[model samples]
Target chain A: MRVLSSNLRLFWQGTLLSYRALFHWLRPAQYVASKVFMPLAQMFFFVFLGTFATSASNAGFYIIGNAIQITAVSGIFGVTMSVGGERETGTLPYLFGTPANRLVTFFGRAFMHILDGMLGVVIAFAWGVILLGLDLSHTDLPALALTIAVTTVSTCGLGLLMGCLSLITVNVMFVNSFVYFLLLIFSGANVPIAELPNWMQAISYALPLTRGIAAARLLVGGAPLADVAPLLWTELGVGLIYGLIGYVLFSWFEFIAKRRGILEVF
Target chain B: MNVRVLFKYWRTILIVAEMTIRQQLMDGFIIFTVLFQPIIIALLALWMLKGKGPDYAIFVVVGSGLTGLWSSLLFISGNSINAERWSGTLEPLVAIPTPFEVIIFGKNLANVIQSLLSMVLGYIVAAFFFGYDLTIVQPWYFAVSLALSVFAFISFGLIIAPVFVMNPGVRAWQNAMEFPVYLLCGFLFPIALLPGWTTPISYLLPPYWAAVSLHGATTVGTAPNEIFFAWGMMVLFSLIDLLVASRLFKLMLYKARADATLGME
Candidate 1:
């Protein structure tokens, strides 16, 4: 009970710190530009293209897809770059030296970005709902919210995994871009997974957003939670696997860096 | 004296542009931007436009290609100053004898050239992979518009470079600006589809004019006068953007020198 309470406190405190840092450290223009307008613009770009390609209904498909896919960008790039950013700013050594449990510290620091990713999705969805006149009356709001939350968590896990990779990889830019565009392609954000070749489809299944996006489309069509339950379960398991593997990799790398005294080398 | 000085400055800008292009080519990230991202966008468009006629496919192909060009300009040319700062070279680069604007414009030149490669790659993908027949009724007009559009885009980059240099935090805005510009510019579709209010905004931006001229030159039944008007607008916007960029660059240099924050961040 005490341990759980301490972890909870850490989570809240970490979130508060990130929230403060986001606004205080970042200029208002930048925050609004990146966090707000960028996702909306991305959604608009694809939705319009989809609209041109087929019809308004297809545009709605892309609207929901791209809107939810914002989590992949915000959660992944934010966490990964923040990791590289800490190193560049010469603060990683101090961070790793702290006595707190690494896993808790990791999740704690990333908690708000997870929320921020969800915020991006919400904003995009709202834009779609308003601009595209997507009738959400048929949508199960609770189910959609739950699916979004899980998707955020799942993508955040992959982001954390990439963050761990950033610790050892000096080419964070390439890694981040590769991961980002890879997800953008494979996750059916802009194209249907069914259109992809068989091997690519297999690869897509292992990724975070495939099931989430699938479930999202269904949810948007007013499918019940029970129908989408299987997909949500698969997504949850993927997130857990990534989180666990990332934690292990981070611990191993941290141990090696500390032993070699090269924590700040890169 | 004025002509001689201007020639020397032009030489310096060219040198900087050459160096920037070489350096950027060596960057792994550029490969993704140049090759991977554009191809993915084209493929996505192809998939989306599969059942649609070849005309839509060609439009999206060119659109995605131009998206790559615009993205490179936004990230590369726009961030060239920020990149220098991060590398601790901004101060020394600024302290050099050449006017700072010359160096940035040179960098923008290199980025513009690099972005053109996307168009070529986009053409190849559209023609070979997708087997779409591209017909340009006026190749010479298209060539002129393409050349003018490059200058217009470089000028556009110049307008934003100062913002990145002045406030390092605004570097974050680069990503934000990209899609918005792409949407507003209507790189994939006609700007007519955008609501009544946005038309003026699209008209003001250079990319919109570029897109209009490019599309007009390629499509059949386009009026020669319309294409010329687009060319004229691009040139006008480029001139206005350069004027604005000149003033902003001067202010940025003055502030950075005064604050001793040229490369601190």
Candidate 2:
């Protein structure tokens, strides 16, 4: 209980520090413009394109898909960029030298981003319904919420992987953009997985968001939680795998950085 | 300007373009965008149009490729000055004897030259991977339309580059401008699918003119008059953008020197 309490304290502290750093770096207005308004416009663009390509009934597919994909924006971009920012600001070495559990510290900073990403999805979905009149009356709200939770954790695991990779990689942003576009295409965010080639479809199944997006579509179509359990389980398994791999990679890189004493180099 | 000064200016622009190309090549962000973005966008579009026949596949390939060009111009060329500012070169560049606009013009040219790879990559993907027909309606006309499209987009980049240099907030504005322009300019789809009210706005943007001209030349049975109309509109928009950009450049220079805000952002 004491250990759990301490971890919880670290988590809240990391979340507050992340928010404070964010506000300090960007003005409130700029943050809102980039984080809020920009995502809304992105959603509007895809929703309209989906409508043109398919029909109004398919808008929910895009609405939910894009909403969830927003997690990538926050999860992947946010996590990697946070590490990049630390490196740029010359605090990375100090961060590594600290005695605290690295995973707890990193996860604490990254934790709120999952919520931020979910907020993006919620905002996009709400905007879709209000502006585009997306029909959500048939959706299973509980199932939808579960899908969101799984999607956030799964994508955030990938984000953690990206953050860990940033320590050793020279061009983490490039990797982030590559993963971002890959997800956009392969995660059934824009195109249906069925539309992809067999190999591509197989690749999608291995990706973090593909199963979660499938579950999301089912929930949006009013499917029961029991119906989406398999997908949810698959997504959870993928998330766990990514999380474990990320933690291992992060620890290995941290050890290497300390041995080489080049952690300060950008 | 005198003939000697004109020669000197042209030489400076070439030197800047040469250096900018080398610098951009070493930039991971620029290279990633240039190489990966177009292919992914084109592939995604192709997947969406899987059963829409080979002709539509050709349209999507070309459209997605050109959309990549536009995005590169906006994010890379448009933010070139901002990048220079962050690197502490903007102040020295401004202090140079040559007009800064000349340097930016060189940068824009280099960017467009680099972006042409997207077109080639798109064609290669379509022809080899997707197995779409590689024929054009009027090869010479298409070639001319393509050249004009690059020129028109270069002019568009010039206009935004100044706005980006002058206002830090314009970075957010540029980010905000991206997808909307992609939709409005009919980069991947026909603008007719959009509401009627947006038509005039699309007419005013250079990308729309480029798309129409390129698409007109690519698609068979497009009336001869329609092709020429696209070419004419492209030139008109290019001229207008150049004029507007010149004014903005002057204003930006004046403010930058006066306030010493060239490196502010």
Candidate 3:
């Protein structure tokens, strides 16, 4: 009982610390510009150009498609950049040096990333609906939330992996660039995966972005809850597996860097 | 005259350019990432078109070429800005006898030349492997479009360089600009394919005009009047961006020098 209480305290502390750091770093003006306004601008750009040419239904799909695309891209950026930035700022080491349980620290950081992703998605989605007049009736709120949860975790995993791999200062920029284009190509953000070559489709299927995007498309297509089961399961499985892998690798890397005194290289 | 000083500094610019190119090529990871982008994009295009006709190859070739060029320019410019600022080397450049504008111009010229070369090479590879035809309607129009496009993009790069210098942390923001540009500019597909509301925003970007001009030049077999309009807009945008960038750079230098002295105190 005593140990359980201690563990709970550690988790709460880690969570609080992570949240504090995240909010501190996010410049409110830039956050609004990037996560909110830019998406609305993009929606406007696409809507004005293609509305007359395609069916209204198709236009709706395009809006939803771009919305999800913006969400996922912003989500990934939020996770990876935050992780890399925290590492660069020497806060990761400070957190590690604390008496908190490593697992709590790990999960706490991932939870904060998930929260950030949710905030970005919510802002972008709200902007799309209100400012761009995009229809949101196609969304199955519960199912959509589930899919977002899976994607957030999965992306957090990938971000953690990148944070583990990169040197401190350059990590966020390099990882963001590398992953941004890869996700754009595979996730069918601008185009459908069916339109890609067979080999490219195969690669897309292996990526978490593909599953998340597929699930998103179904939700936005007004499909019933059952229709998105396969995607949900795949995304969930991938998210869990990647999340575990990322946690282990990040913790191991942290340990190694600490022992080798390379943590100060930044 | 100060022409001798400019000439002397020009050698340093060349060395910087050469070193940048060598580093880009030798960095196996970055090379692989850069090379993979076009290949993946081409494959995606082939899948989408799916034996309908060979005309889609033209779209893939041009789109991938433009993408490669854009990526090269963005990567070099952003990385150069971030690297010089973080390494503290940019401070000394101000003390040199050469004018700052000349040095800035030299750097921009070097980056443009390197990016153009890489883009051409990538285009060749895509054409050879993917069966892309290299036909052109109006070579002069194409030439003009290319020149204007590079100038406009490099100007955009310059506009953001001060932000990068001030806060190397904002590299993510700089990098983030690529996707919006790629999507809205109609690189892989037509901007007409985007929804009606989004079309107007695409017009604000220089790449959209470049793409339209190129499409007109290649498909319509003449430089349309719109080409002149695009050229005019690009020149106007470049001038505005240069003015803002120059002012911001001056501010950055003043602050940086002040900080350096304070640190010594």
**Residue runs of model 3 more than 4 Å from their true location after superposition:** A19-26, A37-57, A60-62, A82-87, A91-99, A127-134, A167-172, A188-202, A254-266, B1-16, B19-56, B63-83, B121-130, B159-209, B224-265
Could you tell me every candidate's TM-score relative to the true structure? 0.90, 0.94, 0.76
- The whole-model lDDT of each prediction reads 0.81, 0.79, 0.63
- lDDT by residue (tens digit), candidate 3, A1-266: 98789988877776666555654545565555556655655554444323433444555555655565565444456556545656677676676677767776666656665766666566656766776676668678888777777776776666656655554445355556567557766877545778667998887777666777677778877887798888878876776666677678768877888899877575
State residue A30's C-alpha deviation in candidate 2, in Å. 3.4
* DockQ ranking from best candidate downward: 1, 2, 3
lDDT (10s digit) by residue, model 3, range B1-265: 1235446777765665576666566554355335555555555454444353555555555666566556655665656555554556555767876555455555555566555553465456546866666566677988898788777776666666666667645654544565567677887667766668879898877667767766666664444787788788888777777777777767766786877731121
Model 1 segments more than 4 A misplaced: A1-26, B1-8, B28-31, B91-95, B131-137, B166-172, B254-265
Which window of ten consecutive residues has the lowest lDDT sum in model 2 chain A? A22-31
Error of 3 at B171 (Å): 8.9
- iRMSD per prediction, in order: 1.8, 1.9, 6.0
Query: Which portions of model 2 miss their true places by more than 4 Å?
Result: A1-6, A19-25, A55-57, B1-8
lDDT of model 1, residue B29: 81
Better of 1 and 3 by DockQ: 1
